[model samples]
Target: MILITGATGHIGSVVLEQLLRKLPAHQLAALVRDEIKAAHLQAQGITIRVGDYRDPASLERAMQGISKVLLVSGGGDEDGLQQHYNVVDAAKKAGVRCLAYTSRALQNPATLTNQLMVRHFQTEDYIRASGLSYLLFRNILYMDTLPQFVGPQVFEKGIQLPAGQGRVAFALRRDMGEAIANVLADDSCQNRIFTFTGAATYSFTDVAQALSELSGRPVEYTPIEEQEFMSRLRAQGLPAVAVERITGFLTDIKNDQESTVTAELADWLGRPPTPLREGIKEIFKV
Candidate 1:
């Protein structure tokens, strides 16, 4: 049996749908914190195990009889690392054969602003030391994040970036989720690390052009200093720390330090990953 944690989340929900196409609903289990939010999944015939990563006993109960466990990372929480460790420990105790983890792109331990990277590294280390077969999906920044950062302005004015002319190797979350499903279905993916990204690289200006074409209106791309961009977000009542974190990621992309997209994603999915224009159209439903 395959158990998917965070089954109600964006990537997790997509992954669950794709996996259901391959495995029977009876063979699949969804570990969710809230039974109310998981009514739809249960209605679809999946085994719903109510659990939270923060609770070790809950995780232990959820992993019962599961062959593979997909440990989706928790969102920005103070105990995120410890929570993940609890899942890993429970998976070990449950004798899960494979543990698939969702991680960030960069593996370098020195990247200061790479919060996800650091947490992933710590989780991976724990998983490795557990002597269980493991698969790591070090996913690139999502094209979906573009909507979060650019959507508000796209409807009013247009998209702006602190990235200037820099290109980012952004992947759609659905594509990443599909790749994860593929990995889970295949046993050959054991002890492998996949860096997933979209089929093509795109600059901020290129994205703006795509939006302009889709909406049939002029969308402008303005490049400003990172500090200036943070100031703008601050003026809009965004929290100071949140603004800094977002802008810092933009700074990493602008420096061309995060433009590398490995071919593993396309190979695993057996097709070209989604392109930026197509992703944007899907997001805007245009």
Candidate 2:
């Protein structure tokens, strides 16, 4: 059986849904922290094992009889890297035949040296050294998160970010989930690594123009200095950790670290990924 960790999370839930369409539920298993919370998965006839990445013993228990596993990246917690290491070590000791991980895609490694990206690359090295056959999907930033970055006042205050003319090839979470599930559903899996990105790249200016057209209101892109960006977010009552995370993303964009455009996602999906304007409409309902 194949087990998907973080089975109730945003990406995990979509992956499980797509997998069910391609394979029988009985052939699938889910690793959840709480059995009671995963009742929906059990109802679908999938085996549910209670486990967490932070607990190696629990992961060992959950990996029983599982041949393949999907190791979803941990949330950006302080101990996130350790949590990932625990999962990989446990899977190795449990004799899992193959392991898959969702990783980050970075074009300019020097420009994007944030803690989060560093953690992903370190995890990739650890997984490779574990001697397990692996599938590494290096994903671009999610288009779904644009709404969060823009905030609800975009129509009024417009878009104010540290990114200048840099562009990002942002793919949707659902499309990535579908592509990952398709790979696992096939019986002939192999060790491979691919970067999943949108067909095209877009800047914040392009996003503002698209939003204006869809919302029937004027929206402008006003670039700000990094220090000013921090001040504004803090003035809005955001905590220091949240402020740092947002700053890291915008800084990465400003340095053109996320400007790579790849066709792998479309190649895997057998169709073109969603366009910028079309995706904005779907997410913002504009």
Candidate 3:
């Protein structure tokens, strides 16, 4: 059976949905923390197994008789890496033959300046050391999060960030989920690392222009210093941790770390990935 962790989450839920279309219900299992959210899947005849990454015993039980497993990355600073390690150890102990993890598309996993990437790199290392066949999906930033970064303030205040002349190849979460499902269904993806990115890369200026065109309102891109960016977020009443995380992304953008464009996503999806303007329109419901 193919077991997917974080099956109720944004990406994982879409992955499970796509898998259901390709694989039989009995051949698929979902590791979900909330039985209520998973009731629909369970009703569809899928094996809904309760598991928490923080609970190794639960993972062990969930992985029983499973051949392939998708290790969805955990959230937050606390217990993120630890939970990943727990899942890796439990998967190995349960005799899972193949493992796949959703990782970030970084130039170098090692020597990460972003703490988030640090945790991901550490998990990649641990998974590699487990001696199991694995697929590391290095994904670009999600296009779905564009509005979150730009925000409603962008309509009036324009787009503000520390990034200057930096571009990002932002792919949609739904597209990434589909590509992941396709990878797991095909046996050729074993022991491979794939970097998934959008066909076109865009700078924040380009995003501002796109938003302006789509909304029929002027939007401008304003570049600020790193310190100013953090201060502004704090002034906007964001939590300290939230400010730090946002600043990390802005730092990565300013460094042009996420600007790389790849064709792997299109190849996997058998179509061109969504364009920035199109994705923005969908997000804004325009």
| Best TM-score among the predictions, by candidate number | 2
What TM-score against the true fold does each predicted structure earn? 0.94, 0.97, 0.96
lDDT winner, 1 or 2: 2
Clash number by candidate, in order:
0, 0, 0
Candidate 2's C-alpha runs over 4 A off are none
lDDT of each candidate versus the true structure: 0.85, 0.90, 0.89
**What lDDT tens digits, residue by residue, belong to model 1 across residues 127-192?**
899999999888988998888867576856777778777777888899899989988977564598
TM-score of 1: 0.94
TM value for model 2? 0.97
- Give the alpha carbon lDDT tens digit for every residue of 1-286 in model 3: 8998988889998998989888889999999999899998899888989999888999999999999999999888587999999999999999999999999987655544567777887888999999989999999999999888888778888988888878899889999999999999876545898999999889999999998999999999988898998998899899998888888877888777897789999999999999899999999876
Best by lDDT: 2
Q: Give one digit per residue, the lDDT tens place, for model 2 in 1-286.
A: 8999999999999999999999999999999998898999999999999998889999999998988999999988999999999999999989998899999888866557365788888898999999998999899999999988888888889999999988999889999999999888877557899789999999999999999999999999999999999998999999999899889888888887888788899988999998899999999999
Q: Is candidate 1 or candidate 2 better by TM-score?
A: 2
Task: Rank the candidate models, highest lDDT first.
Answer: 2, 3, 1
